[model samples]
Target: MLEKVAWMNMLFDFYGVLLTERQKDFMDLYYCQNLSLGEIAGEFNVTRQAVYDTLKRAEQVLSQYEEKLGLVTKSTAERNKLATAAAMLEEYETVKSDGRVQQARKIIEEVLEM
Candidate 1:
C-alpha cells in the first residue's frame, strides 16, 4: 500500500502540474488517499459513476501527459543510472584504486546529469 501511494504520488506530482485544481483534488482524494467512489461522490455531490468517470478521465489525461512528456521514463532512467552509480561507488570503496575512484566519480556525474 505504501508502494502504491508512492507511485500514485509520483504520477500525480508529474501530471498534476498539467491539471486543474479540481482534477488534482479529485485524484488526490481518490487515488492517494484511497477514498471510495461513493465517498468521493458524496463529497463532490455527484453520482458514483460520475466520480468514476472523473477518475477515468483524470487517468487518461495523466497517461497522455506521460506519453507526450516522457517524465516517468526520464525518472526511471535517472533512477537506474543512480543505482548503477551506487553499485560502482560500493565497488570502488572496496577496491580503492585511483582509476576506479575516478571512474566511479564519472559515473556519479553522469547519474547527476540524468
Candidate 2:
C-alpha cells in the first residue's frame, strides 16, 4: 500500500495536469492528504464505492498516459543514469589526473544538459 502511494505520487507529479479536476482532487485528498475512501466519500457526499471507482479510473488513466507518453519511464531512466554518473564523478574527484576522469566529467555534463 505504501509503495502504491509512492508510485501514485510519482505518477501524479509527472502527469497530474492531464487529469480531471475531480480526479485530481480525490487523488490529492486520498494520497497527498492521506484520507481514506470513507473520508473522501463523506466529504464529497458520495458512497465509498463511488470514491473507490473514481480512484481506480483515475489510476487507469494515469497508467494509460504513462504507457503512451513514457515520460515517467524516460525520466526514471535518465535519473538512474545521472545517479551513476554522479557517483563516478565523486570517485573521479579523488583522482583528477586520470584521463578517464575527464571523460567522466564530459558524460556528467552531457546528462545534466539533457
Candidate 3:
C-alpha cells in the first residue's frame, strides 16, 4: 500500500500538469492530504461512490500517461545509472594512488551530465 502510494506520488509529480483540475484536486486530497474516499466525498459534497469512481478514473489516466510517456521510467533509469557511476567513482578514488582519480572523475562527470 505504501509502495503504491509512493509510485502514485512520483507519477503525479511527473505528469500531474496533464491532468484536469478536478482530477488533480481529488488526487491531491487523497494522496497528499491523506484523505479517505468518504472524507474526500464529504469535502466535495459528493457521494462516497462518486469519489471512489473519480479517483479510480484518475488513477487509470495517470497510469496511461505513464505508459505512453515513460517519464518516470526514464527518470528512474537515469538516477540508478548515476548512482552506480558515482559509487564506482568513489571506489576508484579510494584506490587511486596511481593518478587514475582524475580520469575516473572525468568519466563520472560525463555520466552526471547525461
Q: Whose TM-score is greatest here?
A: 2
lDDT of 3 by residue, 1-114 (tens): 999998999999988888888889999999988999889898999998988888888899999999998999998898787778778777877876546765776776776776
Task: Please provide, for model 2 over 1-114, each residue's C-alpha lDDT reduced to its tens digit, 9 standing for 90 to 100.
Answer: 998999898899898988999899999999899999999999999999999999999999999999999998898898888878878887777877777777777787777777
lDDT (0 to 1) per candidate: 0.79, 0.89, 0.86
Superposed Cα deviation of residue 28, candidate 3 (Å): 0.9
User: Distance (Å) between predicted and true CA of 68, model 1?
Assistant: 0.9
Per-residue lDDT of candidate 1, residues 5-108 (tens digit): 67667778887877877778789998878898899889989999987777778878887888898897798788887878777776777777577677767777
* Best of the candidates, lDDT: 2
lDDT agreement of model 1 with the native: 0.79
The root-mean-square deviation over C-alpha atoms between each candidate and the true structure, in angstroms, is: 4.0, 3.7, 3.6
lDDT of 3: 0.86
Stretches of model 1 off by over 4 angstroms after superposition: 1-8, 97-114
Superior candidate under lDDT, 1 versus 3: 3
Cα TM-score per model: 0.76, 0.83, 0.82
